[model samples]
Target: MRILSFNIQNLRLRQGAGQPRLDGARDRDEIGEASALDPADRRLSAALLAEAKADLVLLQEVFDTDTLDWFNTRLLPAAGLPSYPHAHCPPGNDGRGLDLAVLSRQPVQLTSHANVTPSDLGLEAPQPGLPVFRRDCLMVETGGLTVFTCHFKAPYPDPDTAWPVRRAEADATRRIIERHIPAPSQGLWLIAGDLNEPFEPDAEPAIQPLLPPFSTDLMARLPEDERWTYFDSHSGRYGQPDALLASPALAARWPDAIPQVLRAGLAYEATRHRGAHLQGVGRHRPHASDHAGVLLDLPGI
Candidate 1:
């Protein structure tokens, strides 16, 4: 099974006067005056997905089910890719409607942990009684693999304030996986998503609970210099927020399977990657997303 994990940056469908339009791959704070190249952005996004041709696609920052369905049916076909028969997007905790989504050719069973509070998991929330996850830890079971797809809290406005929340989220995710799988080390499972790890090199990682000994960091298989999957246009910093963490058993089964980081959709401004770009990708606009897509090929899974 070929699986792709991508953070399709704030993919929201808006009801325009003429027809519904999808939001560009830019945040509200980033847009000062330049007109959004939404159509071009989505075109590149679809193009990259078409190129990957993954059997199971795990996506983050999608708006809702309607948006996912529309993109699956409309944009995908236009990009020469068939629409996935199984697509799901459950509402998450994000106020802006950004949610986790999945697209698969095979059947899938999905469960949401959006409302799981700290007390439910016996963990202390940064804020009393609040949910541990900023968005959700979506559990997807398909093709003999139990996939935990998540989008953790970003180290935004204040990294210090966001640390504990992300830590709790990581701890809760580990607990949830252990509770469900019984013996995750022996199970066929993996966690795939944009972890939103902080850019601070000196600070301790909040996502350590999900790392090594518990799950193998598949991205580490790449050369250290090529591990980055996200580019911060603001700070010009490159980070590997996108991850494909596999269970020990799964990683052992496919030790040679290194994830393919698809950067064709990223903007030209992310110059660290000297790879070929998709047609029409500009300096900062007309791009697929701020983060590149990560594809892992697990044959005969």
Candidate 2:
């Protein structure tokens, strides 16, 4: 089975207008015309995702259930996908009122849902705040495989102060996943999503280890030349942030379950994401997301 993971930057593209329409006029649920509803951009992202030929999709930064419903109904159908029978989306504090979502062509068993909030996860940062403010995990079972979708906190400009905050959030996520699979023989477990941290292809850090006795980052198994899931629109240089991690047993069973990065949809034409002041409504520009999508192919059992 093929699976795709992406953070669609709330599916709001930057266009002739710098930002999206984040004014108070918009309600709790409104996604269209955030950039004039560029039919081409919307169709292209949806098509690129469908081109993966995936049976499952773990998506983040989607506006809401309504927006996801719209995509599944209109966008994906336009790309020749008449249906996505299974889906799960829990609202998040993306600030702009977006949330994390998942869509699948096959049946999905939502085993668990956890809001990794500061209080819920027992994160100890300081008096002011905890590690992650708005993050959640959607753990589901499908096709004899356990899947978890996460959208980690972004490593903003402040590395010394806020970077570790993001790292702490990731650490909390790691613990949550680990709690589910104490031993390696639990089952086919896979984690995928926009992990804002940079994975040093050569050396895996202890704080964020997703390999060996625990799990292996499927992306690292591919040739270096082909491992990139994101590009800095401002610099035009490519990198890898989105990823997939699974157990050794699962890796052995599906040796060909490679992590493929979809990069065709990472380009900014006219709009720039300078916040609500410079831009208008959204955070990143319209084309795709600040980050590209990463997919994994799990052949049928």
Clashes of each: 0, 12
lDDT per residue as tens, model 1, 229-287: 99989889999888889999999999899999999999999998898999999998889
lDDT of each: 0.91, 0.63
TM-score for candidate 1, residues paired by index = 0.97
Would you estimate the TM-scores of all the predictions?
0.97, 0.77
Off by over 4 Å in 2: 12-37, 111-114, 117-133, 184-186, 198-213, 268-290
Task: Give the lowest summed-lDDT range of ten residues in model 2.
Answer: 273-282
- TM-score of structure candidate 2: 0.77
lDDT of 1 at 96: 88
Model 2 global lDDT (CA atoms, 0 to 1): 0.63
